[model samples]
Target: MLRRTFSLLAAASVLALTACGSGSPSSTGGTAQGGAAGGGDLTKVSVGVIPIVDCAPVYLGNKLGFFKDEGLQLDIQTATGGAAIVPGVVSGSFDFAFSNLISVMVARDKGLDLKFVANGASTTGEKGKDVGGVVVPAGSPIKSAKDLAGKTVSVNNLSNIGDTSIKSAIEKDGGDPSSVKFVEVAFPDAPAAIANKQVDAAWILEPFMSKALADGGTVVSWNFVDVSPKLDIAGYFTKADTIMNKPELTQKFTRAMNKSLEYAQAHPQEVRDIVGTYTKIDEAARSKMTLTHWTVTFDKDAFKTLGDAAAKYGTLSKAPNAGDLLP
Candidate 1:
């Protein structure tokens, strides 16, 4: 029931973005503009984005006319998970995507020529306030990471941030991460999954993290900061083909995105408002929810930590060299 309610609200937000027209692209632009090919007019690009707080910059950028001023029209495509959006990016259905740094790594490993156009969101290890956590039901026997062994846990993505971060945390807590079975469950559905005992715990993020806690989910650990004190969690990226063939457009996107990032950092309430506009998160929850730190600067240290965690958790086939990954 809660999940259904969330879906309805998300649909309304998408309609709101569409109806606003100034920030988001006109829904009628597809046939009129000839399907993101503009023919020397404003360049139209389809952007794949997960409907999460980390994507605040893209929504804010659209709302603020940053992308419009850059001579671009964004066709926003919402997806439930970053992995689910990879095919669209690879097939050119989505020119760019708002995705986690870890998801980008997985795509690159699978031979997708993804490149970073701009940094998305990062964290300074604010445990109670940041967007990552390991959560269990209120009365679950799991009280710490060590208790997670020989149990099933849920992640929004299998080989991405949730699994890697939780594994690292478990290892640090003297537990065998490999012994824990990881499953994929969308964040929106995770709280109910926990409430029904479908999964023993969930590695989730806000606003789902807060929702889960509100639904009698206890915090096993919200220590993603301990995994990487300063973390670059998400980024805006596109295919290598786009960057090479459309250098000017890519640079323009970076500039506009950076401007939006600056604005998001400077205006938390405004960011929250934008988030509420595109998500089912209520205004009250929006005010209380911890927002992701918007950043244009990529953190090499955080990337290294993520790479190391992936390698240690057996997600990466080989150790990642930053040069090969970042563009």
Candidate 2:
């Protein structure tokens, strides 16, 4: 959510470097030829990811050898938020990355060539029981989304999906969406921010959302569900040229990623188990956290609705072209 000016400069510089250095294979070591399950030379891929419940499938997929089955050796990198991940992908630091749909759209809006290759995570679409929601301190007067007007709300990102969907929910509840102020507070820190009265409400995700509730925080809105019931929240994405020049690589990644999604969905306990390996989330929080819906397909209609809301809320200059962005 914190997009520094230098990140854009770094992106441009790295793009040029990647173009010049691409002819030679990267020095990063991978499984030897015929070492993979599919018996071919393994492509060493670097992936940027955020350490959160939404990204559990990718970690699970790697653990289950799905990537190896596709002849890939993944070198997964963790960033704090999409702010770094988006720029990393654009600059070619990552062969692929996981990010929310709105961040991808914002990158595209900025003339960065990025595309969603596979589904990452979606909302369960069940109010008060979804993976994430807006929470206020217990006994706070802000009892509903409408009451959020003129209050300071904390989101991980200011203009990305969090605030965009929240604004939609506020307007739907007859609140003046523009009247609310949004601040950037990372999910890990948001619970404390709310507790200390630093913000009127914080839109948080698991396992922090579950922790906030356990600590007596109150849920006010399931923002994603309020925006659209079938919303696809995030996905695996890569540079446009990666799709064009290395079609086979992208195809293989998509297949492996899809497999991971399906496996995670089928094995919810495994998803919780895998989450602990990458993130600092403890076992108890992992078990109690709400799991996001995982799938191989994108809900284009839901995405369009989210995009339109983003545009209306000034997150984007205009809604992104789904045909161009979606795989």
Query: What's the lDDT for all of these models?
Result: 0.75, 0.85
Decoy 2 TM-score against native: 0.91
| Per-residue lDDT of model 2, residues 1-327, tens digit only | 434233665754654364322332233233445545556678788777888888889899888899988878777877766777787777676788898898888888888888999999999989978999999998899999999999999998678889999999999999999999999898989999999999999999988998889889999999999999899999999888889988888898899999999999999999988888887889988888899999899999999999999899888899888998999
C-alpha RMSD for every candidate:
7.0, 3.6
Candidate 1 C-alpha lDDT tens digits along 254-296: 8998999989889988988988878889998898788888778
lDDT of 2: 0.85
Q: How many backbone clashes does candidate 2 have?
A: 0
Deviating ranges (above 4 Å) for candidate 1: 1-40
Model 2 clash pairs are: none
